[model samples]
Target: MKIFEMLIPMTWEGLKVTMSVFAITLIVSLPLAIFVALLKGSKNKYIYKFTSAYIYVMRGTPLLLQLMFIFFGFHYIPVIGYAFTRYQAIYIAFILNYTAYFTEIIRGGINTIDIGQFEATKVLGMSKSFAFTRIILPQVMKNIIPSLGNEIITLVKDTSLVYILGVTDILKAAKSVSNTYSTFTPYIFVAFVYLGIIAIMTNILSSIESKFDYYR
Candidate 1:
């Protein structure tokens, strides 16, 4: 009971760190992903190639490796190295990694949209922007909701990787308590904490998915 009391506040602190990373990553990445997806589909070959290369590099690497490189490796650079804090490094890595993923997911959703819809919009003499905002984007979002939800859930778990940088996320907090008390109960408690988070996210995502069911 004493250990459980101790675990509660430490785990809550760690959960705050995890939630900050997840929320910031999602909020920042979503718009960037939309922009990148559009760039990937642009008529300008240079823009298309650059965005494609970025996506390839980001998606090709393991996120854990990326986090390490950003947090550790960047410190070796001449001028920019000194600017990165641990949290900054983690946020940069998470945003960049998830942006590539969200871009690809959005691109796939865009591609799966029927070409005839674009033609119909053009026939109606609507501007391209209008058509996309009014007609195409809604359907694309509907198609991609499930994939996006999976990524969000993954992000929650991935927050644990911040421990690599000594960021004191939930797992790290639990480990700290476990070490101090010489008991495994902290780990068990943290496991339930994580499970509770996942369950809540699953429920919320399911509700959002239901809102899009009208698309079908």
Candidate 2:
């Protein structure tokens, strides 16, 4: 069979797996990150310390290693052992990893907001939480767009990492065809597909950032 003939359908099938992981991770992680960030910023020493350590561990480790542990290592942990399927393991790992990253991004963004905004809120008799939700967070979101854009693009590429669990993602599918046909065409084709996704993401993020231009 010609490489393209096999590669096309296989790549499409693989893309389905990749997009499912990516879409679900973003949906769950984005909001979860916000809640975690608030915990990380808490004045209660215990709460802050625990949240900080979790974020540190997640950020400090390699995501590939994390995925392996969740899928393989979890099987050794008493009752939860062998409880999750490969797909569920990947989802857990991806969501946990991205939530840590997005939390840190949000923290950095809140730091970048002008302190005077906080003072102004105080003058207006606003609670800190009220100010954060109604005022500060909106600007923090704008400030974090560039970082989020980069992370999101990285997520698209990282979807390929699911193959570590023997999940048939785009790169894995492409590899199967390449090995059979003895041609690099499958790899090149998937590279174009990846680039196309990143390009669309960049454009979407650019539009989102522009919408916040009035913040300045």
Candidate 3:
């Protein structure tokens, strides 16, 4: 019972850290991903190839290695090395890694869109931008919501990876308590905390997905 009592505060602190990484990554990565997807889809072959290579590298590598490299390797760089804190390094890695993923998700969504819709918009004398914004994006978003939600949920769990940089995230907090008390209960408590977070997110995402059902 006393361990449970101790678990509460520690878990709360860790939850704050986890949520911070998740929120910042999601908020920043989504828009940046849209831009990347556009670049990858560009008519200019060089732009498309460059963006494709970037996405390929980011997706091919493990995120943990990416985080480690950003945290440790950046110090070797001349000008930019000194500017990064561990938190900044983690955020940067998360943003870049997830942006690559989201770019693909967005691209897949865009591809799933029927070419006929574009033609219909062209017939209506709408500009490409107007057609995309008005007709294409909504349907793409609807198609992509399920995939995006899964990524968001995965990110919540992935935030624990920040512990590699000694960020004292939720799992790290639990580990600390487990080590001090010589009890495994902290691990179990932290697992439930993670599940609770996932549950809440799943609920929210489901609500958002339901809102898009009108598209069907």
Full-model lDDT for every candidate: 0.93, 0.92, 0.91
Runs of candidate 1 with Cα error greater than 4 angstroms are none
* Per-residue lDDT of candidate 2, residues 1-216 (tens digit): 588889999999999998999999999999999999989888999999999998999999999999999988988999776757898889999999999999999989988988998999999999988999999998999999999989999999999999999999899999999999889989999999999988988999999999999896
Which candidate, 2 or 3, has the higher lDDT?
A: 2
Selected candidate, larger TM-score, 1 vs 2:
1
Q: Any residue pairs clashing in model 2, and if so which? A: none
lDDT of 3 at 93: 96
Global lDDT for candidate 2?
0.92
Supply the global lDDT for candidate 1.
0.93
**Candidate 1 — worst ten consecutive residues by lDDT sum?**
75-84
- Please write out the lDDT profile of model 3 over residues 1-216, one tens digit for every residue: 877787788888988999999999999999999889978889999998899999999999999999988888878888776647889999999999999999999999999988899899999999988888778988988999999999999999999999999888889989988988999989998899889999999999999889989888
TM-score of 3: 0.95
- Candidate 2 least-lDDT 10 residues: 79-88
